[model samples]
Target: MSDTPLLDQLESGPWPSFVKDLKRVAARKPAAKDLLKQLDRSYKDKITHWKHGGIVGVLGYGSGIIGRYSDLPDEFPGVEHFHTIRVNQPSGWFYTTQALRDLCDIWDRHGSSILNVHGSTGDMIFLGTTTDELEPTFAELTAKGWDLGGSGSAMRTPSCCVGKARCEYSCYDTMDFCYEMTQEFQFDMHRPSFPYKFKIKCSGCPNDCVAAVARADLSVIGVWKDDIRIDQAAVAAYHAGEIKPRGGGSPYAKLDVKADVTDLCPTACMSFDGKKLAIDNKNCNHCMHCISLMPQALRVGTDTGATLLLGSHAPILEGAQMSWVIVPFTEMEPPYDNIKELIANIHEWWSENGKNRERVGELMLRLGMRNFFKSVGLEPPSQTVRTPRANPFFFWHAEDFEAEAAGRKYIKI
Candidate 1:
């Protein structure tokens, strides 16, 4: 009889089976075998065989290792003391071949040899290891210039997209920013200072290749405050179907001027009269949609900056919510002092007032944006002119209108 009969049943369909891989690993590893047995038992009982609650980690570190154990240790001896480890990845996700080899050699020596690539918090996920192996593994990793990523109530490893390194649309040096932020907050990342976990992600532009807006607690998205740069000749080329829309990513053979470009502008700030493409730079919202579609014709403005947003969290205590803009724009330069000061101040406030396990986003929701921003010394930026209420909802304050004012006139919004 198959040892993992119920687990084997999962291989019936055409889809690739993790059960197959587990079985393969089980050939030489008792933990993998026990893991399969526990899974088969789970299939029969419809419940997990693992339970949490073990405070285990390397010396002098508060997080980065999560301990787990089997409820039936006698039935699954190999997985009795299995724990997960979060090895931090470098900025820009860069790794030399030797560095990767060093990681693999250490894991193979002291752990289950199971590994997962970059996690949401940007860590090399080492799946399973025993308590005995934890210290040795951490020691070896540190010797190789590697360290554990964050877990529990700590600052997570900061992540960023491949920025000025390769992508032309990148408005800032994301790699540099990520590296600096990591170095500056290594203490918080390892020491567990916050009431809950805090995460930061850098997106070179609103293309947001890292999805920072939807995921990170603090989303730093690149923006340009100046007018979008236009090349009339390139616009004519696209209009004459001499260029492909969206460059290599385009599925369309020709640029659909109305369908793809001007009409799709969030603020309707662009117009193409067949011969000429005109943009009302004053009304432009810097959406980046038109620029993405007509890359040859349009480019981001020269006045590069970043937009800071707060309160984004993945579905946990509360369901997933997108971040809201905090700083509409701020000029960025090397050793970003202004943003760093702002972050430090936020940490001071959040660490003081945030409840256990309450995300910063949730705090913003509970306290109301006004109260939260008031505590942090900020105000709501102007909202979009067209139906800002249902959309980003800038009509959040009664102060949005004066005490005795009859009506409001919005110019830039």
Candidate 2:
């Protein structure tokens, strides 16, 4: 039935794989069949038939569609004008069964049946559509309360964890914040006016369920400033094995307080007293390990806000980066102007100075973090710490050295 024996063997596994599903689809869909043939040919020849078609998109929108063309158009006629459509997903990726069915019904009518639930940037990626189908497809989707996500040099879709709705460790309402931002920054999402793509991701707590600090250009992580609230009776119960942990595990059965929580603390701020556990809140870094281990005994502090981390991105020019602390804490109330203004300022600075195709993190690395702060009119806070380094590579500034030579106090910038 198939010429590609090795490719066919990939379908033998018990677990469902995309390759198997593609083969199944190929049996019924001409496009899929051609696609499989082309794939086999490419594997045999050690090459591909895909090529980029420069800058094709729907009317009024400058981004979102990634144009792809097949070189073997005669052989793969159905895939000749294949294009990708990015559908903006709801915050936390929560969807009802009816909503999913509705989305599938709309897509089934428009283009190829292939779909990617959450692409790299967390958008609902619809694969393989044609240029002629773009407008009508977009219109129908919009009529059904769906819209295109961002691409190219625009702000991509914002993602978040199901905060207060599902996670007990959530410090703030991440889902609501994500929705609010998506609605507010509609223009930024649809328009391409930046040096490169910008992305935002929010995590409910420092557990960082969504990996926001490592992935997003701008990251908002929920945090607590005050002391962790301790239920002394619950702490006693946990120690005595009278109750279970939050997720139905035997309480303190496998817990080694010295190894798990206290030793693991970055600042060594936790200590278990004879009667109850106590934490040195001053030294606590707001790492969520203790809260995760003892959910019943510990809850987040009342003074909750979001920490803003800036310039995180996957490697392109510089390297993979974890976001640096920009604003350590900012109130995240409804009508989040404080957060919006900060983002706007960062965008303005990056747009004015960034080179073509350079990410925000790469720009910061090239221009120096000091210049970035000064350009954006932000004072460097004491909380700003460098990413962990294995090697020491520190250099004193010329001005600071000059001041030191002159026997005056060299105040660092």
Score every model by TM-score: 0.89, 0.90
Residue 260 lDDT in candidate 2: 66
Runs in model 2 lying further than 4 Å from the true structure: 1-3, 242-246, 249-253, 387-413
In candidate 2 the C-alpha lDDT for residue 42 amounts to 83
RMSD for each of the candidates: 4.1, 3.3
Q: Per-residue alpha-carbon lDDT of model 2 for 1-413, expressed as tens digits?
A: 66566567667888777778877776756666667777777887789888875677888887678898889999888788789899999888998998888888777777777789989788899888788888888898888888889988899989998898998778789999998888877898898899999999999889999999999999899998888999988777766666565546544464555566677888888887656688999999888878887788889898998898988887765578899898888888988877887788889999999999888888988998788887877778767756556438766778877888888785456
lDDT of 1 by residue, 377-409 (tens): 665576411235566545444555653264665
**Clashes by residue pair, model 2:** none
**Which runs of model 1 end up more than 4 angstroms from their true locations?**
9-12, 315-318, 383-413
Against the unseen true structure, what C-alpha lDDT does each candidate score?
0.84, 0.83
